[model samples]
Target: MSNSSTYTTRFPLLAKADTPAALRTVPGEHLGELAAEIRAFLVEKVCATGGHLGPNLGVVELTLALHRVFDSPRDTIIFDIGHQAYVHKLLTGRFRDFDGLRQQGGLSGYPSRTESVHDLVENSHASTALSYADGLAKARRLSSEADRDRAVVAVIGDGALTGGLAWEALNNLGAAPERPVIVVINDNGRSYAPTTGALAVHLSDLRRQADGARPESNVFIELGFAYLGPVDGHDVSAIEEALHRAQDLGRPVVVHTVTTKGKGYEPAERDEADCLHAVGAVNPATARSSIPAGQSWTSVFGSELATLAAERDDLVAITASMLRPTGLHPMQEKLPDRVFDVGIAEQHAVASAAGLAMGGFHPVVAIYATFLNRALDQVLMDVALHRLPVTFVLDRAGITGPDGPSHHGVWDPSMLSAVPGLRIAAPRDTVQLAEQLREAVAMNDGPTVLRLPKATAGPPIPSLARMDGLDILHRTRSGPLDVLLIPAGPLASAALEAAVLLEDQGLGVTVADPRWILPVNAALPAHAARHRLVVTIEDALRTGGMGTALAQACQDLAVPTPVITLGLPTAFVQQGPRAALLAEAGLDGPGIVAAVLAAHPDRRPPSAWSATTLATTPRGRDDHH
Candidate 1:
């Protein structure tokens, strides 16, 4: 039942056994000193492993104050996104294992109920803590026992405040006036980037007010909840006082604590947008370098989107507070009016895009493929039902390594394909992404989803321009085929290499990279029929994913190809390098070779394919055939 599979020994400073001595018995001045120590420890541990940095740094004081003031496990505290729970992890008996954070079989990236009693929730997605808190509060309220007096606190970021689900929870919590729900709003003025929309502006103006002079009845108050704060989040005494005040209110109350995203650290403090919201890796001396120079899918999308927006005036981009990551920063800068960052409101983002499409505008929603799950209802009902042509550029379309299971977009293709009138295209590289994006925008159809991996951009393949849909990448010389390879997207590159190794064993192999890959590729059945065995590979889950889809597709077509599908298992995957995860999942070049050669043991031919170079075009169009 564990989320991760990695384990590690404890660092002396990060040992949880020393927490009581570090703060509880120490002088009041020690809290600030301890906070500084904890921040440094977090920066060091997380920078090596790469995790939610700015968030943990920002919440150092808040987490310290919370742990000090309230008895956790008894007093339930739920972090909304849980991305900012590193501070909580450090204090509540997980300090030693923090270095193993997000690795396979190691400490989880987010708060996990299974990890510890202090960690109340295993949340990774945004804007659900309030609802969970409300439910917990209601459970306590309806308790028959007279002595159930534990408090329920939900810590949420301001970016999450813009989501409609949070508002829905607010309305419900507001209805029950006597329910004890403390909604702590950690307003740092950003969500991946500086938050957008009029509400953010209002919050900014309110924050600008001197301490006690701010308006009492704002949005949260309007919902019949007591509202407090605009308090300095870094002040341990002040934050503790605010939490005490919130608990004393005896009703659903929101405490607006304004903290800098990366407090104490000068570089993080000066960061304009997300403030190193989540760092990759950096040298201890200089916290800077990341994985070597390679164009990420986000960079390609950002650059291409800016150019696309420049050419088409009717086109408008919408993101659920992910401007920088989704590659909309350039568009946001150049066409500020056109780009709409609807805070962390994915549902609203989709519904609003539908409205734009209705008004004769070509609206493109650029969202993380995982986040897109939140807005599916809106996309289906508001956009698809209305036949509004809205282009959904799904970034991180498949296994997003290092972010863990919650952030992986493995099921996106399978989920979206189920929605009628939705056409999904899985691109192989940057050129295909650009062309497909253009095609998706130009077609005045209902809805189209473009699924691309994280940062698969490189030099375009020379034979890319003429590639067609569902074409075979490798062809045997009319020999009895031992294996037929089917790779979802760029995994085809890996399969190609595996095929070379398989050929050396005298096992005839054919590799196919279906550029316009969907769950239901008609060519797959006929293609599979030609081989003795068919193996499907994709960077997604095996259950109800691309592999399953391909299996079902082959079954439906009456193709009796004994298909051995490889994909992510029906378990939560941990965080790691892309190569590592791919190899572990048996989808990388070496892994694929191992699996293929294991399946068939016979002849040994010379290798045919070289190192795979994925083009953004269809495989059929490639002249290599």
Candidate 2:
């Protein structure tokens, strides 16, 4: 059945409660029916489009209760790990746009400021909403507006509470006892995987206390905030009652609500691992993914790491609540004692890895490239400064699609390039990822980073030759080399295609993949001197990225070759397909051809051949990136 047709007839209650104002008007007796309908609608649309189905399904009743209790856009409701705000979106007149969820130029997977006024915080990074709520509440209290008394609610998952930022915000919010902030702890007990550390244990104890074990000294109470029940999150009326009490407090309060992660859906509830937290296109009825099984970069990394772990007793793994997602599950399953799940604390994970490395063990820290930004200080000071032999496996290293700006990892290269003693590797294929993983772990002097994209691994691009540890993928067969193409990671395919096209146009092009893209390969500047123009393509920020580093290397060597850098602009790239975003940023095969032709000395006028002219000339333009 068509989505439009299914959407129109299947959700009568959902249709009526299109907005929060309309949701407040929903009869209390029919609120249950509305929640059911919304869950059904979510399964129907989100399964087809692919999104955070499990988290959204779990929060149907909780979201409905929040809308009924607080006047949003005025009350200011912020959801930590914004993927859980799917139900909030449905309540805020976004139900009609569900069919286009996470698509290019469509509704985002997480909360988006541009999509609705209700969404104040656009960043979907976990454990940040509490801090935002704290700030917003303080702002509201000091405001002279008539509606300054409006409530500020922060609905954060128990998993998110594991993050250090949440505690930091809690410390500040609790210290200001006069501030009226409603901190709702949505205790689902999972973030991607099961929540770990002492916090989870404490929350588990709280859940036991709710079952009439004994009244213990509550942490929230000790933190200087009024504590409410460990209420049932799935019960809308019960949640609303707790919210009412919290609202009546007129001071900082904590409403601890117990809920299941994948509440309503049987498939999600039954799934042991992350409750099917995030999914691709799936069969709506069975809740089975429809995406055909393939060897993804993640799986390859996981497999290789597991193999490496079997061989080396000194190899251990650490993940910040992303054990399975970051491809550490294989190693975790094989050597359970060696793998550590540090909850949602990236900084702790990196610093702790450094500690482990200090104890004579090589700790492999598996994390998303985007999340690694949170631990930059630890990476630089704790690891790199100490010359710790820690391997950071950065998954989703480049232009990750769907999750949008905060999730796209285009800034890692720029951010980590200056970290002394840190080696960064951008693998071109699954083979390279495995090889690089092994090589990274083998290093004992300093930290190493192996970055790979979120896409499925492509066939290996065999190198024609290896020079100074660089893989020469393509070289001018029988003509003068006019352009030297340096592509980072998966962009080697596009560079190879552009090389073929440039060769056909009678311009000889040499393509090379600098396996370790950091510290500037020693042989690159010398080889680049042979070509008239050097083009560096990467799925990273153009500023201070591999391209800039390469250009700097040439300049240091007095290589007079004019360099053209093609990469994402230094801006937040929005939600879209990875390929589409790359093409838009002019990092694709045809785009590379256009960039090369525009900068080629033979194609451009003699006046344009000057270094200054080549630097200023427009090549690939992506204003959105």
Candidate 3:
């Protein structure tokens, strides 16, 4: 069914059901019914629109129980990694618009403060809720307003708990005995892949026991917060009772609610390992088969890295709880001892990898571009400061559709650009990604970073002429060079296409996708010197992207070419198809051509508008990396 049709069909759920069956039912009697309904609703609605699937499925009952007891907006509920808040959205008067999920100007994939009053926080990033909870709780205490006697509840998952920031928040919350913040640990035993470490195994043991299980309280208890439950999360009444108990306790408390990933779905339950954590657009009946067969860029990297591991026994692989997504599962499967799944702890992933590198082993720290924001300090201090040659394979390092602002990998290049001596590589194709990975692994002087998009393949463009600094993909024939196109990440195809379009319009264009687009290549200076207009396009933000860097390089080199940058704008872009976002940002083929013409008005032909030759332009294979 179409999203619009589904929205119409499910609109009535907007008005909170009068004495809903879940609300009326006693703690134990048919508690799982509401959960079942929620799961079915989510599958039906989300599959059509393609929002966060595995997360919402796992926390169905827990979300229902929280809303049932707590008066939201008054009593704040902050969700860590808010992608799992679909059930929360449905109950809080957002049911009608739920099917319009993650579309442009529609309901966001993550919680949004603007959407409704029920949403206290709009955090999509992980390991941030606990800290927010601490601030809110403390602020309420200091105000001493009678109306401010509200509860601050942070629904943090086991995955988010792995982050050092979560621990820092926990420590502060625990230290403040006066503050009343309830920490709900939604333990599903997975974060992308099955969670790792002694803590995960310990939590698993606690959840498995039915009776008299001494809740091993280390992080919360050691810090002096009361800990409760290893409760069956599917039991709505049980969850309500636990939440009430924690609220009544009047101090910081940890309510560890144990649930199953892909709870109500039989397929999800049996398979395990974060069942269908995310789903792409596909026919609902064949959703499972939608992910194409054969290797993704991640799989290729993993397979090749694993082979590299065999040659060098000291080679170790690490991931920040993204074993499956980052394609490190194969490496883990082959070399269990060498591969480390560090849970949702990005800082630990980078720092630990640095330590491994320091200890005479080659460590590859693989992570999603967005998630790596949490580990900037560690990367700069522990890795780059020590000059450790840690290779970070950044997955999803560009515009990620549907997941929205928090999920977009647009800021990695900007942030990483600040780290001195960090060699950053943006591969244009799968072959380049593999080759770059090998190159990064071999580099021993300093930290090496390779950024690639979610896609695996693109049109098979022939290997470009390799110069010392840049790979010259295309060079215009004998004519005044009007434009120099710099391709960053997967946008190389678009740049090349734009070049072809401009070429037909009698504007000579030179296109280059820098193999290592970091620290400002020497060839960029020469290329910019030759062209009348210079344009740099990347999937990252324009503020500190390759465009800015190239512009800076030009300034340092005393070049006077007018630089036109094309990329994601400063503001947060909403979730939608990647093509839509690119077009909106004026980074698509026509957009690029338009921007180029705007910069070089004199270069445009007299009948530029009358004869649109873009359609007839011979298309090349898009080699996406």
Candidate 4:
């Protein structure tokens, strides 16, 4: 039989052209077929490309119901953390481009504004949709066309209410009875890891309560929202009915529709550890993917930390709903009592980590670099001010490639610079990671941070000399230094390559990985003074990062060397491969050389610089040394 016929026999209604209208027209008999088809489609496409498969599979019917109930562009639907928006994208005229999910110049893993106006919020961060929806609703109310019956729907899943942002919006929205917004809680009892908090407990109680019957104390109802049902989210008609009720309310309402996390696919359903929240490129049928040959930076950190935890009785691990993702789960398994998964509340994570440290325990708060920004105030006031012995392992330090702007961890350097007494270490490779982990834990006076990029653990480059806390990886002849390249973790390889290139072009080079990137090494300025021009390279924004600090240090030490900082521009980097993004941002070897050349035209390689330019070029001769 033909493929069409075979698919028809299996999923009769779904084998045809699947559109919003087509989904709406699907016969009641074949609703199951359509759901199955969507699941099949997700498995076939998402598995091969590698994406948030389990989340999409869980929300097939819910997505269909949402599209059927709401006129998308007219009635705004904002998905919190956008990972569950795959089924929404599939139904909203983007099924064809689904093949290129998370790829460069392709459909984004998360919702994109360029793709459609239907995607109101592009933020991949959790528990943000409500705030966006609240703002949008306020704008709509202020506009002349405020009287229209347009629905504002915020689909939040996996205990997003555990966060303060959602609660703040909820308080405002619920207090104002006239403002219309349908808050759909896609309850699946997770947020990367199994969500743990008082809010998560409350949600559990809500889930346990009978359908359409308010619990003894309903938070939603008490908060001025018309609570609908603990409905079956997997059932399309049931969810549609709840949504219809919400739309008819003409006020703030919450339709608690509980669905399975990783619903249909066996591979995801069976796997209990996060239900394969995100996956690599894998076989569609078997859900199999090849693991990286060597240990990843995450795995290496995890292994080392676990060993450290085993030795130290006071050592504890903490995560904000990301156990496996940040590599803290291993330590958690080894020392269950000491590990804390603080739901989606990073603010709480920081504050509690401070508390733990105050209690004479060494708290290692392992979290994503981007997420650490959320709890900066807590880090500054609660942790740093108190001089707590809290070690922050910031995983995914820079250019978290394909997950787009909101997910990239590049802002940590700039943001963390403001924190007093906080020592930040950006490890270049696996060896440094282990060494720094020990250093971070050993510090009892103040907070220490270990920031690592999201990539495989590269082989160690032996240091020629240890200058202060920095590892001088490469050094040229003893005479004069034309350049001092100090690339942080992500751009270390590129900086070394650029040093080789500069050396070949008759330029003296010294490359280093400042093990402790923060606290600006006191000895760095004196070393930099020996250079004609100091080029500080990093993948973070050059504005307020390590490069800027070093440049300021040069001036502070009375060094005349002009510092050229090479880093990502102060803008949101687009989604792409890490290597490609680095090149585009001028963080690669060729790009670094170009940046150095651009800073000093006379220092450009002889082959690159023209005769006329060289004749007119004023600088490059080292005077300080």
Candidate 5:
């Protein structure tokens, strides 16, 4: 916790305007001072906690103005990509809690409903806020006349409008012009990197027009929206006035306010790469990350994919507004024409990749696993049904930390496994990532996916032997196989550690990595038959996931061995360290050992287990395996 006296002294105006009600009481003239204070506070605290610093820094005044103009809690406000709602959180009496932003049991990086009444949507995904607003407004109209008077504002920007859902919501909202829904386009002209595609060009034109003559008509006007702005988002007075006019209109309105992402911070403004969009714990003075650099799973895949692309003229890569973050920048830098940035349109990217594949090009659609959920239909029908040679390299495939539930990549394997011809690969380390990627692209018949976690790629874990497609990571030197442990992707390390602990208890154990996780490798069931018990560990949902599929495969093959699967439950996991979450979920070394002992047919009692082992057992069973 920060010193209260020091905090109050630094930002006197901010101290007074802790809540929206209190903010409304603040003198209008001192609002600029308050905004400045908020920016400084954000730079200090967010940089310290390592979160969406640039997005939050960009929206200080806009957030302040919205709270002051609209009666929040009564008049609901929804931030599109809720990372920009840090300012909203601050104004809603969360200023003191800023110290714990994105930490476990602390304030989330995005809007969390449990955190405050001011936050209507906990969405961190790009777009979808307008749809939420539209629903809320319709509900208000149906509920009561008093509710109808309440305004619904959807604050969307940073390339969120590029998403198809945002357009769908705009279409619905525009049709009902009488609905008092304020669509604030907080255009900073970026989503991680600069916003791409035709929409970005259109917004650029609008910005240019704003500097000169007022345009008579625009896209918003054509959609039946009362278009306002190209207003300066930093000017709280102008934004409040525009918002007030929008309120009086009693109709759907579009207020296009332009703001600088990473505003007031020189380092953020100067940063060409994501504008310091998201950062680790940083030196506040220089706005540089304090954490030491390391090669990540994303980097390994990116480097290898670029190398492969250079070798194969037919290979191309695509990203939906995250070229740099997804590690497509290497390929983009080397072969400019082959890499595509499709804005915040994952659906379009996947469909386009299918088209690319159909044209004799094997397209690699590199994207975050969570974002892939948006285009599952495309991956299934458009790609898999057609059997296109498109490799989806999913970065951040598992339990991603800090960004919270919405950002976790736990659903991809379960969902993608349902696609008939799609093959999924979970690389155990950097060596396997490169090797598996080659295998993924070489397959000419159907679609393939390579999923990896967000953590740094540790030293390579070499396979003892390759059986069929599975990598034998560990095996007892001389004993009957008591338990077979199958780990998905990076969990191979943890599985090996558990094997050693099990071996310490005089139990023979075998650990295997199913590099190709989906379709349950043909030889897996036969191997399961060799052991008395089989355990599968993954950083995905327990239901309908890798474990479930493997168990079903074993049952089909008449392998009588009992299969006990360990994975995250079907629930929204909160923001925290990935390591901590995995340990809590019983996916760690000690946790895995405990689960194995509990399930093993020849298991010894807990009292008989080593004291060192029992001391490390995870506390609760309700949330763990």
Candidate 6:
């Protein structure tokens, strides 16, 4: 039967079922019918909401087997890369809320803690599930409840295995055999793109081996865990049988299930790139993005970097298992020799980039802002300490709406704040992205970063003047500035509109983009000295972000320009529409106006910025770090 085909009749068992508990009452014979229903439901709902459709479609039978065989909440269950947890949510009585997924005050695209008691770990970052499972199992053993009958299950994908943390947890689990835990290796064979490294090849070989007596060929057995199938993951009965065998062992065991990445949907399965991993709202009849492929920051970087690579043979590009997502395809295609895909190992990518830099090659390390957290120490010690001319291109630098808190690229700046000789730039648009990228690659003295948000790349905001690499976008008066509106990256356009709002209210505003936001450019504090109030806005944490650095600079310059920082709040921002989330965090023009007015009650704020408006998204993740 085609996955896209609708059932002739309504679901018999699943239609009225509210939760996983209801599934317990379902007859064993009805399992196949329920699985079919769930698959169809996912295809319809996910397409409407725009989410991780492919991952969920791949896990329908596995999910059914999991819920049927194991008692969740009573028996702990955790999903790494929680985007595949939609089936879990629906089984846990969230079927009605499925249509509202990824919207404000609606269903989250990933596992949300407050959403239910069944979800223990709402982790989105890959490879942390094993470590989390180990810790929980150990805690259960160490405490007075040591004798309790409970099991901890971690469903981790093969793509996540490329990370070092998984091996670290494996080593620990192997050393102590007393802890009873189940590690379900969901081997779909892709992470944004095809998964790389030695383990993937090892697992691929293991998948072809027959079950039972294959212990001699198994690596999990060597790690002090019994190895169970190369099970048919799409077959609910087989998967359940495998789980039963794992439970019977009463010790750490690996239940390897080989499944398709995008099993049901024709479009997703046929997609060679990313398997439609994460997508926007698509037509249910035909999986196509409603949003246009406008030149995003990722695209701009890809094209420009590819151009740079063509000109220079010494330039090398590296990505962490995300070639297409991070926009390295152009380079990967044009100069395959220069491109390096280090799998999901961010730590290795950064360190290897450092090695590449030392080898007389200028390495451009392209990675997601959130994922960079894994490689902080590596980048600091290996790259920054040596002050190599390695350019770190952080693609999704701010609030990545649907993927939830774990996916947001907010903490990169605050984490890298102490790294000396490190420079950071936030480009306002496509033109600046190209210019800053070229400058970063050309600079051979120290490490640099070109950070941008995950949104459409718009027109450039023309600068009225340039001082010490900073672009002065707007200035109210020459004599004494009332407010110095220092906007970071994409927020420059919005700052311009905010200036108009303040100006209409008789408050002079000077909006400038410190192109290189880090190191507190020498000209910034001097410019602030002329202003009464220095207002800084970023899409990152205001505490240690660009605003924090600027405030410290003001203190050092002995300039008493009282600074007001505006950005995202200090918390785990929930999944919603990107624009709505920004508005909620007071990063929008109206919110900026309200904050400006609240800060300066005497000056007040105009009702509107003018006929012309600026749409700015901050480069920071939160208000304070």
| Top-TM-score candidate index | 5
TM-score of 2: 0.96
Which stretches of candidate 1 lie above 4 Å from their native place? 1-22, 144-147, 212-216, 456-468, 593-625
List TM-score per model, in order.
0.89, 0.96, 0.91, 0.93, 0.97, 0.93
lDDT per residue (tens digit) for residues 1-625 in model 2: 8765667688878888889999988889998888888878888888888889888888888999999999988889999989988999988989888878999889988888899999999868889998998898788778876656788899999999999999999999998977889999988878888888888998898888886855656788888898888999999999999999998888899999988877778999887887378888889899887668778899999999999999999999999999889888888888999999998999999999999999999999999999999999999999999999999989888899988888898888899998998999999998888888889999999999998899988898999989889999998878798989999999999999989977877898899999998978888889889989899998898878788888888888788898888888878888898998888787888778777777677795333324433442343432110
Cα lDDT computed for each candidate against the true fold: 0.76, 0.87, 0.79, 0.81, 0.88, 0.82
For model 4 the TM-score comes to 0.93
Show model 2 residue runs off by greater than 4 Å.
1-6, 213-216, 604-625
lDDT, candidate 6, 279-298, per-residue tens: 78788778887667787889
- What is the per-residue lDDT of model 4 for residues 1-625, given as tens digits with 9 covering 90 to 100? 9654665576555545345667777776677777888888888878777789888888888888888888777788889999999988877777667768888888899998999777878878788998888888887787766435677899998567788888889989998876788899988887786778777788888888754566555888889999987889998889889998888878999998888888888888887897478987888777777654567899999999999999999999999888898898788888888888878889999999999999999999999999998999999999999999999999888888878787778898898898899998888888888988998999999999988888877778788888677788898965567788888875788888988887777778899788788878888888777777777777677778887888777777778888877677677877888888877676778777766665653654445645322432222111121
Tens-digit per-residue lDDT, 239-308, candidate 1: 8898899888888888888988888776677778663888777664566875575888788878888899
TM-score-wise, the better of 2 and 6 is 2
Give candidate 5 misplaced runs (Cα > 4 Å): 608-625
Worst ten-residue run, lDDT, model 6?
A: 616-625
Candidate 2 positional error at 520, Å? 0.4
The number of the candidate with the highest lDDT is 5
Q: What global local distance difference test value does model 5 have?
A: 0.88
lDDT order, best first, reads: 5, 2, 6, 4, 3, 1
